[model samples]
Target chain A: MTVYEFAKGLILEAGGQVRSRMDESIQVETKSNPNDLVTNIDREVENYIYNSILDTYPDHQVIGEEGHGHELTQLEGFSWVIDPIDGTLNFVHQADNFAISIGIYKDNESYAGFVYDVISDTLYHAKKGEGAYINRQRIKTVEQTTLKTSIIGINPNWLTRSKSEAIFKQIVADARSARAYGSAALEIVNVATGKLAAYMTPRLSPWDYAGAAIILEEVNGVVTDLLGNPLSLIKPSSVIAANPQIHEEILTHYLSHHNEDISAFHQYLNSK
Target chain B: MTVYEFAKGLILEAGGQVRSRMDESIQVETKSNPNDLVTNIDREVENYIYNSILDTYPDHQVIGEEGHGHELTQLEGFSWVIDPIDGTLNFVHQADNFAISIGIYKDNESYAGFVYDVISDTLYHAKKGEGAYINRQRIKTVEQTTLKTSIIGINPNWLTRSKSEAIFKQIVADARSARAYGSAALEIVNVATGKLAAYMTPRLSPWDYAGAAIILEEVNGVVTDLLGNPLSLIKPSSVIAANPQIHEEILTHYLSHHNEDISAFHQYLNSK
Candidate 1:
């Protein structure tokens, strides 16, 4: 089987396990803060993916959110980044709106990506040159949309506490509407499918966005850091994913004015 | 058939029509503001529901968001309140998060309620004394949860523009997480199903919350205006729906401190 097919199989299998075991009681622990949650299922899923990768491609290196995989300082040959459960708090609380994400890279370039929405039975996947698909249907490029007529996904907390709160608050006011689904992977795919014009956050780990970024890119959507820079494969950074027009509009009209505050915020995140 | 059964049938039929017609090109128009939207499908669904109700119960009065029904000064006799498409913007854009909502009232008392998530094919329904159900399974009463550990659903725009922005912002910070699904009926049912501990908004029309209120109450949840006042069946009002403990806590600890501001906001809404 091709590497892309194998990755898809692994994600589907992991998603199946999550769907079946969700009814049983789960053990949850706090990570960075009380609200930052992780569950036993997350660790188990990560372990299964990691072991499966090693058994198939013994030389492949894996990095996952639950620490069951290698911690690489840099992307090397045949590297995989995975998030076992992208929205752990949603998984533990709502029992839905979470996904298992897998991104395969050769050296530093994206090769394939998969994001499986466990509850909904929807799988979003893409190969480097091939286009994106939801389940079996190929997704079309996001239609051109304006900021005033588009729905955007953003965490409400950013408006209340982030250094760029003023700028974000203005965007929220100007947009058609705003939603916070609490899953970066799903939100990115939402943009890919034209369900949202844009999805942005001030800080997200690579595993949180890695897999879905490939899917979004396949649909002609743009993914970049808040400062309009290419995302770093190894570091947590602010992210904004949108169709070309809306992306350019936000970066040029709104985010450009808050460069210093955004820079300081990025510095604070990196220091932490 | 009982009134509850008839209402459910009407909702399901309307939802089915919505699901089938979703792929067709639609005509959208702005309502109170540019962001406040309505569509031809919304009008079509409302007309279908109103005619269906009148055909079955000739004496029943109807009030709906799309204005196919009566505008009573006070709800009298067998009155039906409905929002044919609850999240019009979601219906227009995402085509997924929106729902069809219907509430049957005997004078001012809630008799039955239904909120049908068209895309997911999930139906949330309840009779006044009967417990709530999603599709076929009966839902349990919301578990006891502290505000610090609970997720909430709220419009982010409220944080930017409402009179109680400070209080709402503080509550958002204290919660586990916050989401905005852009549908009041679904958000209220999110509380009913224990997916959200609470959902609050500064202003909403009667059609928005009418149906979901009964479902929530049947699950031992609380529904009240922002000032802890009983919601009017004939007018727009601020709304807060939550499980009992969180509802009481939010009112006593957070909202109580800002009565004048909230009251003034209510007055402003009333004047408008």
Candidate 2:
């Protein structure tokens, strides 16, 4: 079987575990702060994904949110960027709105990505040179979507005192409506599937968007930093995932006007 | 069976139809504008609920979002306030995040309320005297929650030059996070179930928060206008649903501080 199919199976399995075990007791813990939460399921899920990767492809390397494998300073050959529980707080508190995100990088390039919204039983996957699909249906790029009539995913916390606070607030005011599901992977997949026109977060790690980046790219969706910079799978940064039309509108009109605070913008964008 | 039990079954069945028939093609139409949407499913579901109420309790009065039954200028005995589909846009686009919200009133008082999130198959319900429940588990009133550590449901659209703009922005900033789920029923239900500390919209119709109001009140959760005034069952007004602890804090601290703009706030709060 192709590595992509194997990854898909692994994602579905992990998602099944999450869905089945959600209502049971989970030990919640804090990572960076009170808002940043982790649970035992997160670590266990990471371990499960890591073990499967190692057992199936012994040479493949794994980078995870929890320490489950050798930490790679750089993205080398056949590395998997995995977030066992992308929205751990949501998993712990709400028992929903979380996903298992896996991005397989081959030779330092995007090869395949899978973001499984566990509770909804939706699997979004894509392989390099192929196209993205939500379940079995091939996804299509959005055309001529205007920002004024678009529904965007925005974390409202960024509206206060961030370097892009003004810019972000303007976007929120201009956009049709902004929603925050508190899950980056699902929000990115929302754009890929045309459910949301765009989604932006001021701070997201490599594991959060790596898998979604590939899937969205395959669907002709745009994934980049909030300032329209290319994303790095080895570094954490702000991500703005959108279809082609809205992506161009946001990048050109709202994001490009803020040249004065480029340094502060980069700091806040990469801080998380 | 009690009217409350009868309402519960009716809601679950209505919710079942919404869940099962979600994928089918439905004609979409604009209400006030393009952003305000309604579908054939919305009318069909409203008709189903109205017919069920009429057949079971012909003496009862009903007020629905769609023109389904006799319009009530005043709330009398055994009245049901139903929004056939809350978050119709979410239903049409995302196929999730929408719900069937029913508020049962008797003699001008909230008797029972039910909000069923269709895709998730989760039911939140409460009677006036009894406590609130999610599915079958009784939800408790949250204690000692603070704004600094609380998650709030806030619509960013109010950040424009409205009277409450400054107060709303401060609340968004002071709170740990602000979320906009685009469904008032689910947002209020989120507060009732302790999933969120507080949720408010500048304007909501009677049908939007009627059912949720009963549920919140049952758990000793607070439901009020932005200025802490009691909500009216016969008119559109601002709705703030919150846990027991932070409700006082938000009302006393942020919402009440804007006494200077009370008239303007009143005008904006009920404009929708």
Candidate 3:
């Protein structure tokens, strides 16, 4: 099978395996701090995908959350960054909401991105230079939607972090409403589908965004840093993903009202 | 058919109707404040359910979100409290994470409850004594879970609300981790299935808690006012719903830590 077909078949197969074991007992462990959880299932699922892909393409590079894959200096040819379970806490505790994420980059360009919301059996996929799709239907972000006409997704954690607080509060106070769905990738997908006008998460990792970043861009949506600069696929930044028209509106309002402390926090993170 | 059977049928039909319209062009509106949203779809779904139930059981009382039915007083006799789309904001924005909530109470005792997550096609239901089920198999709260093994769900708004700051901070310090899902009924259902250790929301309306409150109780879970008192079915409260063991830990460690202003807020609401 070709690489794309092989990845698709393997992802669905791995997802099916997970569904069968949904009701079985699990061993949950903490990561980083107490609030972050990792389950044995996450590791096993990642391993299954990793081994399957490696068997198909022996020379390809992989960066996986389970730590079982190779790490390289730069993205050269074919590289896959996999988040076997994107919402691990949602998986270990609720047995749902977690998803399997896989993205393929060819020669430092996002080639294909796939996010399978396992429990719901919904697959959101995109190929570079092609339109985004859910089950093969074309998707596009909504246009000309004002803040009052839009529903924005935000991270609740951003509400308290000093750097994100003032701007975040102003956006919430200005928008028709704001919601936090707990999954950065999924929320961006919502924006691409026009289900949400925009999505902003102040803290995200590359794996958390790799898939949705490509999908949103394919649908004519924009993703940027908080200061209205372009987002790089190499690292995570304070993300603002929205339709192009409202992109500047969000950033302009955010910067106009940002306080000194908020700017200081951003400076601190940039230094790191 | 028995009352239980009839209610189940109604719930399934209404759920299917809501699902079929998921992708239709929608007209959205804001409610009460810019931070809250109401949709034409929300009103349509509630009206559809309200009319269907009233047409079938003309004598039954109905309390619905759109104010389509009578003004709610006490939960007397055969009353059906419905939140046609419990997470209107999620539905309007994410097109997911929302559900059809229905609660059947006979003279103040919960008789049957259904929270159908239309997108996932998962129906979390209980008949007071028949035990809780997710797609017909019996389910229980996470077994042997403690605060350290738990992830609590709280609204981000609580962090900024003056009265909730201390308790909110204490919860952040206490739980292994925390999240804000933006749906009260769904969050309560998460507690029923052990997806979350606890779900704390400072303010809720009866329509928001009616359905999941019943299911949570059937799974050996507890939903009480922040002081650990039983919830009043007719009025919303500062709620903490959890597995019995973890419930007390949250009450003592987090809820109790809030000073007089928060307690007064709770008491002031209860008196109303």
| Model with the higher TM-score, candidate 2 or 3 | 2
Candidate 1 per-residue C-alpha lDDT over A118-176 given as tens digits, one digit per residue, 9 for 90 to 100: 99999999998899999999999889899999999998877778565776888888898
- lDDT tens digits, residues B193-219, model 3? 887788887777777888898999998
The docking quality of candidate 3, as DockQ, is: 0.39
C-alpha displacement of B114 in model 2, angstroms? 1.7
Cα lDDT, model 2, residue B240: 83
* Tens digit of per-residue lDDT, candidate 2, span A1-272: 98888999999998888888877888988778777878888989999999998999998889888875434667778999999999776776566778899999998999999999888798889998788888998887654578887788887777766565766778888887778888899889889887888998767888899898999898788998877889887777878899888898988998878745654666765564
Q: After best superposition, candidate 1 residue A55: deviation in angstroms?
A: 0.9
The sequence of per-residue lDDT tens digits that candidate 2 reaches over residues B104-138 is 98898779999999998999998888888999998
RMSD (CA, angstroms), candidate 1: 1.1
Provide the lDDT at B54 for model 3: 81
What DockQ class does candidate 1 belong to? medium
Per-residue error (Å), model 3, residue A22: 3.7
DockQ for all candidate structures vs. native: 0.80, 0.54, 0.39
TM-scores for chain A, candidates in order?
A: 0.98, 0.93, 0.90
Model 3 misplaced regions, further than 4 Å: A21-31, A68-71, A142-144, A147-149, A160-167, A229-236, A255-272, B22-31, B35-59, B68-72, B141-144, B263-272
